[model samples]
Target: MASSIPLRPLASQSELQAFYIGKDINDVPKPAVILDVAIIRRHCAAMLEATRELGVGFRAHVKTHKTPQIAHLQVGDIPNTPANFVISTVLEGETLLPLFQELFRAGRPVNVLYGIPLVPSQVPRLAHLAKQIAAGSISVMIDHPDQIDHLRGFRDIAGFAAGVFLKVDSGYHRAGLPPDGLNKGGLVEKIITMEKEGVIELIGVYSHNSLSYAGSTLEEGMQFLREEILGCREAIRQHTHLLSARQAKGKELVISVGATPQVVSIKGLLQGGALSPSRHELKALLHQEDSDDIGRITVELHAGVYPILDMQQLSTNTHTGPAEDEIAISVVAEVCSVYNNAERSTPEALIAAGSLALGREPCPSYPGWGVVSEWRRPKGPGRLIVQRISQEHAILGWEKGKGGEEGIPLRVGQSVRIFPNHACVTGALYGWYLVVDSSREGEGEGERVVDVWTRPTGW
Candidate 1:
């Protein structure tokens, strides 16, 4: 059971510093995986900013960074304002509830939405938590009629009308009923009636995507959401008398739509879907798509000794910047040897980090140290790019440098930080990253580890 606790600011900088850098376990040369907190914050912040343009109330998925510290970073010190955290489990909600409950007790409350839809098994725990927690503090999703019936019993048992978000198949089709799927009788009307009768409060409507497909090319997804929200609103109004009463009484219902890819790509397109709109929007939508696939084989048809592959797939964003210089490298191994003899004539080689370090997939070859920036080698031995990856190694090859050993020596046990084609994938691999500033500060050391921060690893 949850009871209101006095609000207190979480630990202090000195304490947090002590906890992380503190002597906790035996030293094991914690082969550090450096993270640029500032840069990461920039990427995450960009995503949040995009939501403003999307014109929806910001409820970031905490799954990206499961740590409370990182979660607070996402919140950016919004005092007296409850952080709107989106999650996938009740345990996740339970872990975060105390933090939010403290805010509520202090008169600065927040809300949490369990991203998963209601399943029969979840009802008992859901009821227990909601009953013990503050009113209107928790919400969950519901898609099928059977789930609603289960929720009704749970609500009755708990003696509290649980908030429900009618799941709609906006586009991604991962969950939620397809927009037309609601036509099999009166599921929509049933949900609307529950809201009116107070058995299940119609808190909001929700949607999701599979995240595997392109998710409707962002533009398509946005258009579909806009139309779905409008259509559902009309459908509810036309069929349900309860919602009509609530509308007449100035009640508002949330229309929550989330999909990192869709949200980031077309957030601004979702304006006017909110029960109420906020003044002054900030940032555009940004999605962290399939960035994990950094170095894998792509079947490029051709004829040669070996068909090499590009390395950009895993290293850079679609809009990656250009490279600084052009240098030539050779493929020590057979040209196509790196890609399981898929084809020939394409160039390939080996590089520093592999699939495990970044994500596993080949990226496009542009001239440069890595795929992070769009450095393409146009002249002579085109740019050397990473192709395939393993947990600790990467396959590299020159796009233009034609021979097995073109110009330079490529060997193992080489320590190199190839500029990643995409920064996000590379950023997530290690626990933390070292910040190095080579510029000297009036006789100070040329480089110093200025900042140290950890990234979220799991739930």
Candidate 2:
């Protein structure tokens, strides 16, 4: 089972004084989303290093943070090299275009992939935007063969080639075609015919192994990875002839796979060199022959939530939950009500953070909406759990003896920080993040509001 840091009161008098010298934690309004910048950078650095070591390209899914500053950190400060990014909404793509344009003007290529399948209505605007920014810099996903027609029409009308990827279903059963027999009915053949006609450019195949998140152990996650690779291999095999034909015309194929669970599992394997055994097998399966005959296969890993972990991420590995320093986001809420449940032999407290603020997503294998940690020291395991949540109330509970001999005496005005079950959704509930440096937290300095970064919300 995963646990939270021990409960501690808000900053002490002296600590509060020190924090007040700048900007204290209590100074911020209640039900605020707090982000630790240091932790996010560390996580991004680790992911970037691991991917670089494995000789694979990384395309960070920006939907998790939806903030350009954090997205920039994920892509790194490298010059000239293109920063690959994936987004879930059209608005996000539009919002990031200016930033991508700036990078392009500075000589660094930046590519954006709208991960969601395109709707006919959205094509004109998307196509126009792609043209204005950088030709072929924006890509979209196409799961169904019919979507190719709409894309082709839009491309002809817009007078530019649009890059696209075939979405392969890797047991998630959510928006993608099955890898095996994908060429049935000459569907892939038609797509290739269109690519030959300059209607659309088939960039690669993409998959999201969401089932990997349900894995209770790292071994289970690895098994999911195997399934994903096998599925992608089948898809590649189905498109081998068509892809080879395109390659002859100077086109490359990308094999992109990820979700946080799969990406993190692969990262761990790469770090331990456990993936070395299967590297040759994967390379053999993914390789294709071209005219000049140098097969171009770029293994692109995409993930979003790994940068800012949550309770669900912590519970993924049962052995030693996520390190205290790894969790970068938390909800700071104040106790609104406290009740003594003599009959149940436990005390309950209501917090200001509720479903609206913290989201209703549940943590697997854990019975709580959020894990409670000390407001001042959020790095340890917590004793109280958020048992229930209403529109504006989170009911926190703990067993009588578990809390203390006298039971946890929570005050009405007391404030505590909660690690949400799902950071992505919880973060969406807030407009901006109250940024803080984790290192300053232990120095008797409360969360000083160093900076505030606005988050993009809505569809």
Candidate 3:
């Protein structure tokens, strides 16, 4: 039976942090979430620097790892840098209030966008959060007029008009109005009317190139980014003639687009000479002004999975680096039983993780739920993958015609780490992360737990 003391994950952060600070990663609970602090820091900082070099704004999404420790790092804590983030849940925004409060006190430029297409019921709570966060801090997404009707404009109620980003479909058909449909139902006129009536300050267009994840090369990812930029531009272009003088000459219209694959490909902008023409073309395309009648077009890049990468992100092949070096989080579980050539044709070991621990999101690169970290780089016996699962059981098996007939390398009680197919949902399974650092030297190459980051649960 499990202990009733409620020691970790369910315990308070202070209690958990005090207990796990100096422990080994293997000492943590089975099938726990693991975060590489150094790797995450490097990934987030590098992304910020790359976007800065490309002259684009960056809005980090907090829907992946909902912990404040990672969220703070993702917000760009350095002085003189504007801090921006988008949240998938109101709880995530509420959970980061202290961080926002700190930034507001320091007078750093800070904004948190509630990144769903607005519905009427969430307005009250969202407006409440807006009232307390910071001036010009809260923004909402709008793709329909009914959403605005229920929002009722935040002017009189919240003491300020809410900032709005018109969601553009970007050919994904996920959400938001398509660029070609801007004039279909007078949506552009509705947006102008909202701004004209002090109902909302049109913050410009927001999009995601999710289709890029299906791509296999960096060039394909870059093409998705270009298409995203063009789609956002087309939306803004459709509305230029209708903007009032103040709205037209007001803030620079910001275009925010990202999917980790697309954002990771932007690092090529700093690569020398190899894609010089592509870089120049992207720069020119990012800033285009047919006439002064329209406001300047600026850009903001947003992504969630780039911080703690996964096998799915690796399949995109956007960033140039070792896969093991970039992928951060993994599921560390112990082998419950070994099923070798007896009942299984190849080799399999029953692990302590199942659908609840390692998510079922599929990756095109491999034919399994997740890959064992031991063989992820193919240095040891062979690749062991989570091929089957129950509620709390996962079969760690090797593919047929593979592993060189050496059999499974795992002992019955030994622990194995798994790189999941989806980092975002996989992380949502645990309440806390067993923090470690793979960037530095230690008794365990990367197996010591340094800190515990607890996250708020549910929406």
- Candidate 1: where is the Cα deviation over 4 Å? 1-34, 43-56, 79-82, 127-133, 152-159, 183-185, 196-198, 209-242, 265-386, 390-394, 398-459
Per-residue C-alpha lDDT of model 3 across residues 107-136, encoded as one tens digit per residue: 787788888898666677677777787557
Candidate 2 per-residue lDDT, tens place, 1-459, comes to 001223223344345334333565566678888888888888888888877766677898999888887888888877877788898876666656667787778888767888887777777767766776777777888876667788876686567778888888988998888987666567678778887888877788888888877877766655666677668767876667766766665667787887787677654454433455554344333333332332456667788988888888777772244435667888889988777655455667778878999999987867878877755533222467788899988888762235444545667788888888899899888767777777664663536766677665765
Better of 2 and 3 by TM-score: 3
Model 2 clashes, total count = 6
Q: Of models 1 and 2, which has the larger TM-score?
A: 2
Angstrom error at residue 168, model 3: 0.4
Scored against the true structure, residue 99 in model 1 reaches a CA lDDT of: 59
Query: How high a TM-score does candidate 3 get?
Result: 0.93
Q: Which consecutive 10 residues in model 1 have the weakest lDDT in total?
A: 299-308
Clashes of each: 52, 6, 0
Candidate order (TM-score): 3, 2, 1
* Reference-based lDDT, each prediction: 0.46, 0.73, 0.79
lDDT of 3: 0.79
- What range of 10 consecutive residues in model 2 has the weakest lDDT sum? 1-10
Output the lDDT of residue 129, model 1.
66
